[model samples]
Target: MSDVKKIATRDSYGAALVELGKEHDNVVVLDADLAAATKTCVFKKTFPERHIDCGIAEQNMIVAAAGLSTMGLVPFASSFAMFAAGRAFEQVRNSVGYPHLNVKIGATHGGISVGEDGASHQCCEDFALMRSIPGMVVLCPADDVEARAAMKAAYEHEGPVYLRFGRLAIPVFHDEENFHFEIGRGEVLRKGSDVALISTGLMTAEALAAADELAQAGIHARVINLCSIKPLDEELVLKAARECGRIVTCEEHSVIGGLGEAVCAAVAEAGVACRVKRVGVNDEFGHSGPAKEVLAQFGLDAAGIVRAAKSLLG
Candidate 1:
């Protein structure tokens, strides 16, 4: 609808770091030899002195970032999701999460959307891993605007934060002037009554498309962007479960401990009566292919979401 402009969330994160670097002198960036791929090169180009290249050592980068945080510097560590969240899990947990350090982890190429890189680069369990860490805040921004906002929010918030980004360029749905984003807040993009489509990251665009399709079939679907995964907006989720009898969660990550499971747990804890249908990567490894094709293959597309919603409603 918004002129179909496609921009990668990683691009937004890169631009955000440059802006933040200019505004906050204490802000520093560290990348594990993937600055270009992670898009942190933008910040490195602008503020060379403030940027550190850790050279493929994600664990060392995590430890360095934690040490920088102790010195009152806001360190944004950038890397592929597989390395940032997987290879450096122990360092992140012990050095950052344990001390509640102000280190922002910018993990790009997250989920099966990493595409041709295959399963080794694709990280579907980053959310689960990061969410398990104590005092860790996880965020999966839906689009470019949300990604920029989330980057700023991560910088402002204290303690460890994981901001997930994707390699594929997705649709931009939010207007710059009208978009309001907070650290732990969930925004409802579309209002409906029949069912609620709760989604995070790039899958939110698909959820919106699904809502449009559901409307054509006389099924009023509420579209909620659950960007904040760790400190999930439980109140909004519960409200959706109560208002809309059926709930469908869409995400690019695995359904194991991602948005899908978080939504189901919230609904259950609230004692709300609702049937939840999770549309995600069903606990499997990613394959090498086009990102869009892979998303469709894994039932993370708009049509797939519509099917899931319809199935739950039935």
Candidate 2:
């Protein structure tokens, strides 16, 4: 296999938006005083007329984007995960979610991976917050390439979509051509019978690496990249429960109501009795440090996945 690229998921959103903007004239990009930080500056430079920077007010930016969507234009609003989901949630729920608007929320710096910014900027509860909102499609792309494809899928799919990206420069696991990405479908990266590793966002890469490590230790692990969270692929999750016998779910979000909890709900409702272990932020505040180190400190890294897999097996 060729070497995978190392790119931040936020970069993928910007690059994909540029391509989408070139293909469709009706596609508009909006930013909340974070065009440069959120990487929407590229789109702004490319499509000055279509790109709208709504200053620092994320709530107003969301309403403005929703207004554009009502006008038949596809608007992608960009902001940090914390402010976008927390501050602008009411506007998002009322103006966008209530109307089932086709507005795309591209939230970068998601979860603890924001690093150095501490817990204030770390939106580990974003998945839970957005998923609770009605008619929202929560998307957490695994890598830069997947983030790019997610941008396209979120745009094509009608309704309110929340795309979560991170600041960390993680490994690009999925090849843009080979990995088939649909809005509500889960992609199985590797198949195994011993245990299943269900993950999303940058944690998917960690899951894959942990799977490889487990394989070297004679533990076969299946890796499932769950891109869509809200309209989760229950069929795939049930299959993992029935076949794998045990599961370990990983995500950058909190363990409370994030990917791990979501998977458990699917397995339980399906009446599939399987061992499930979760590795993620455990409802604790994070400290200032590098993204990778902070993740390791909080037990959201590959070592965490490996430990969870072994514990579940035991």
Candidate 3:
């Protein structure tokens, strides 16, 4: 795993912005004084005139992005998840989400992956917060390939989009030349019948690894990657529940209202008689520690997914 090519999703977000800027003159980038950390500064290097520094006022920055959208410019307001989705909730909901503006929020450093940034920076509830808004499209990309593709999709889609990225540099598994990403769709990476391992964000890679571990135990777990959280791939989730009869959801977010709840809701509404378990951070705040250690402590890694699947099968 150490030898594998790895790049943080935040870096991918910045690279994608450069590509979008080069292609579309209407594209504009804005940041709440976090151009470097959130990686929006890369776009500023190429299109300095198009980038705006909002100077730490996240709420005001969101409103400005909304205003820019009305002027026919595609604005990507960048910030940390804690500020982008937390501090600017009211403005994002009313200013951007209410009118369904074409404002793409590049929220980086989501979940406990912020590591030593501690509980104050770790936002385990951003998915729930962003998903509550009407007409808001929520997306959490798994890797570099998915993040880049998701950015392009959000730019093309007309509505409020919350693009979640992470600080950790995870594996680049998806082949860029072959991978395809839609606004509201999921793909089954591995086939199985004993159980289904569905996940989003960084956990998608862990789910794939867990499938390998389950195979050794003859459990034959299926792996599902769900980068889109708002307009969930209910059709794919229902199909998994019906076929597998048992499912385990993995995410870097909290189990309360994130990917787990989304899957459970889909199963319940479809009347699927499948048992499900959520592999994610519990209803608790994260502590200051190394990112990998914190993820292991909260059981958000491959071992956690495997443990949840075994529990369901047993």
Candidate 4:
């Protein structure tokens, strides 16, 4: 493995939008007065005509994006995860999800990693909200390369998609040239037989670090990045459960209705015999603090993951 380069997934999303703008003329972007913060400003600068600022009305922005999709335009509605997935949920569920329109919701600043933004801005329930919508593809990319690839995949996909991005700068572990990104496939970064550390979003980086720490303690860990939360890679998950006999799910979001729950549901439905443990915010809200501090406080960091893995293994 090479030295990791740190980059925010939101930045990757912005760059991907610009590249998509050049590739597809039908691609349009809509932001709810948070273009700079959500990194949609890059798209606005590159394709001024294709970008639309919808003021602070998140509901109207989502509805307008749904309308734009009806006109055969692939609309990417960009905003903070809280507002996009929480505030405009009714609009998204009714307008886009109900009609099964080709609208991509680029929700940046997802999870408690929003840091000083506090509970109001930090969205930890986006996965729950997005996953509840039928026919909606929920994707949470782990790093820059996956974020870029996910954006492209969402654009090419025909149905509604909710692409979750983060504010924190995470390690970019995947090399774009050799990385394989499929919409519903989980990638195994490490191979081990003791325990499988399945993670999503920024938590994948922590899982990798925890794997290294576990190795030193003579506990081999298999790290799997479940980028696609909805339409999850059930095959890989069950395979890991059956082979490893121990499963630990880590995510920046809540323990409920997130990656942890998804893994549990998959394993239970498949009747996979494995002990499962979750490492995430334990059914609570976020507070104002530094991102790393907040993550460590909630046991969503590497040490936390290692602890969870050890507990599960025992």
Error of 2 at 269 (Å): 1.1
**TM-scores of the models, in the given order?**
0.98, 0.97, 0.99, 0.98
The clash numbers for all candidates, in the given order, read 0, 0, 0, 0
lDDT of 3 by residue, 1-314 (tens): 78889999999999999999999999999998889999999999999999999998999999999999999999999999999999999999999999889999999999998999899999999999999999999999999999999999999998899999999999998999999999889999999989999999999999999999999998899899999998999999999999999999999999998999999999998899999999888999999999999999999999999999999988
Q: For each candidate, C-alpha RMSD in Å?
A: 0.9, 1.4, 0.7, 1.2
Tens digits of per-residue lDDT for model 1 on 1-314? 66899999999999999999999999999999999998989999999999999997999999999999999899999999999999999999999998899999999999999988899999999999999998899999999999998888898898899999999999998898998889779999999989999999999999999999999999999999988998999999999999998999998889998889999999998889999999988989989999888888899899999999999877
Checking candidate 4 for backbone clashes, the offending pairs are none
lDDT per residue for candidate 4 within 61-92, as digits (tens), equals: 99999999999999999999999999999999
Find the candidate with the highest TM-score and give its number. 3
As for candidate 1, its clashing pairs are none
Model 2: colliding residue pairs: none
**Selected candidate, larger lDDT, 1 vs 4:** 4
Segments in model 4 whose C-alpha atoms lie over 4 Å from true places: 1-3
Q: How many pairs of residues in model 4 come into backbone collision?
A: 0
Report lDDT (CA) for all predictions: 0.93, 0.90, 0.95, 0.94
